[model samples]
Target: MKNACYCVTEHRAPLQRIIQDTPELTGDQVLLRVTASGVCHSDLHFWEGRYDIGDGQDMSLSDRGVTLPLTMGHEIAGEVVALGPDASGIDIGAPYLVYPWLGCGDCAVCDRDEENLCPNQARSLGIFTPGGYAEYVVVPRAKYCLPLGDLDPARAAPLACSGVTTYSALGKFRDAIRTDPVVIMGAGGLGHMALRMVRALSGKGAVFVDLDPAKRQAVLDAGALAAIDGAAPDAADQIRAATGGGARLVLDLVGAESTITLGLAAGLKGVRVVVVGMFGGQIKLPTVYFPMRAMTLEGSYVGNLKELRALLDLVRSGALDIAPVTRRPLHDANAALMDLRDGKVVGRVVLTPDPA
Candidate 1:
């Protein structure tokens, strides 16, 4: 039993190919034959030595001690074939969503359903261990896999991460805050999908801000009420003005010092700003305005299984239209990552392990 895999050996170098024994499933693990995995921009962040987010096993450099040389693919989907009897309630041969986060289950965070925050936690099938880049992945806990019936597995993969992150960010403000108008910064992969989600979940105000003319138009085509140029000299004032004094909610999907600065610049007095991007930047705040405006700033990471389920329902019901996907062979993972990094592809690029 042999398996093929794409392994990232060094920073910026192309992933090398390797053959290994087919993974053995633990009694508590569910083994899935890899079908589709989305090449995410975040994966590039790791490859380029930009973002140091992982469980500290493979990284040459560690953030709080998480390392790299890891098999990359966080957002993944496939069919389950084997599981330990201890892994009850999950049937073999069922198509399921893989929740990548693997946590210390008995912790306070896990008990509260915030496993991403678990002190001893790490995401599997990507960040923690050999991920979906290979033909097979061993999932330690069956509880994390969500059922995907009749949905295109390729498109569903990105929903596991990009979709879940953006949707989770929007979910909080979907019901409570001002829905009259909502603003999304960055019209890239996640931003485009967010435009669709906002329209589906929160129907009041839909405004998109992006530096790319093509992306700006795409957001508008996806049903944004207004697509303002993010690079406009007075973009902040323009956004603030367009939203009728201010947008109550602004999702900064491209977080960086500049965009975070722009977010503050474009935000209303009482807006809720959620920063979800990993673009290596910081926000500078004015000490005086923090208390006076009653504005809120929150950071959201990839969502948990509960949020993934809600997002899947939206996708399953056809309320959210995922961007069309582009396919490539497993060996072409480098090109897929490069395309995503260079802004050459739309939607997501999904890699098929067995392209026959």
Candidate 2:
């Protein structure tokens, strides 16, 4: 069988369609006919081939073990087509959300179900391996497939990334989130996901900050306590006022220096800020503030498999509101990426498989 996929043949260039023989399944491996793939901000980093780590420097994906002609999507949902002899539990033809943040199975972190924090060579799908930008894909193990039940594949696809990412980030502020409204920075895809998840987790509510008025309005319509302009002169004041003083928890989904600065400025003493966005930049903070303010800063990567399952359960129970998602045909993968790159995407843009 032939598999067709769109790949980043060159950095900052158009994705090229490539046809190759479908991969043969090995021990414990499973084959999937990709039903939906989400276009993520992370994909932009892969396509650009580097991360702006500030100081006029970049961290190249090649140094991090990414190679050309790679398919760049980690948020995937698909139907099982074939299973290896050792693969069990899941039946053929069942639709599932692929857990793409894979790690070496032998690591201690993996043993604890924290594969996303694995130290070994990352086997993350779409980054270190072929991903769901294709008509078909090979999952390293059946264990990576989470049953989607009745969830729409297009809507469920982002659960692999944005959903689980925000879930894990919010989990870090359990105490604060339950008692106080979280200050969410960036109203992009991840920002919106974080907003919805805050409510689902039984949090007080959320106040969103973004440069876009449209996205701010969208967040307001979605029931956020307030959506302040990130660029406003008194943005921090607005966030502080909205939170009734200062925010106890801030989820920075846009990790740029300005966003982080804004988050810190809006934080109350003992505030916990979790930076989940990959929009990179550097910041310099006074050392004394950490001790004086009792502040905590941390970075959260895409979540572990266990968190993905937990998030899925929330969606299945209908307690979690789905983020706005726009569906496009798979053939428009390049266009979808461009839309997301140009800041034109509202919520999430999911690419559904085009008919064979």
Residue 270 of model 2, lDDT score: 94
| lDDT value for model 2 | 0.89
lDDT of 2 by residue, 124-219 (tens): 999989998889989988889999988899989988988898999999987768889999998766777787788788999999999999889988
- Relative to the true structure, candidate 2 reaches a TM of 0.95
TM-score of each: 0.91, 0.95
User: In candidate 1, which residue ranges exceed 4 Å CA deviation?
Assistant: 52-61, 64-68
Q: Which regions of candidate 2 are displaced past 4 Å?
A: none
Summing lDDT over every window of 10 consecutive residues in candidate 2, give the lowest-scoring window.
187-196
Residue-wise C-alpha lDDT for candidate 1, range 1-356, written one tens digit per residue:
57677877786888877787866666677888777888987777667665523333233434633455678887778788778667887878878778786567678878776777678856545766778787777777787788888888887888888888877888768574344677888887777777777767756757888888988888787677788887789888888887878767888887766776776777767778888876664455887777777788889988877888899998888888777788887888877888877879766889876665
Maximum-lDDT candidate: 2
Cα-based lDDT at residue 62, candidate 2: 97
**CA lDDT scores, all candidates in order:** 0.76, 0.89
Q: How much is the lDDT of residue 176 in candidate 1?
A: 49
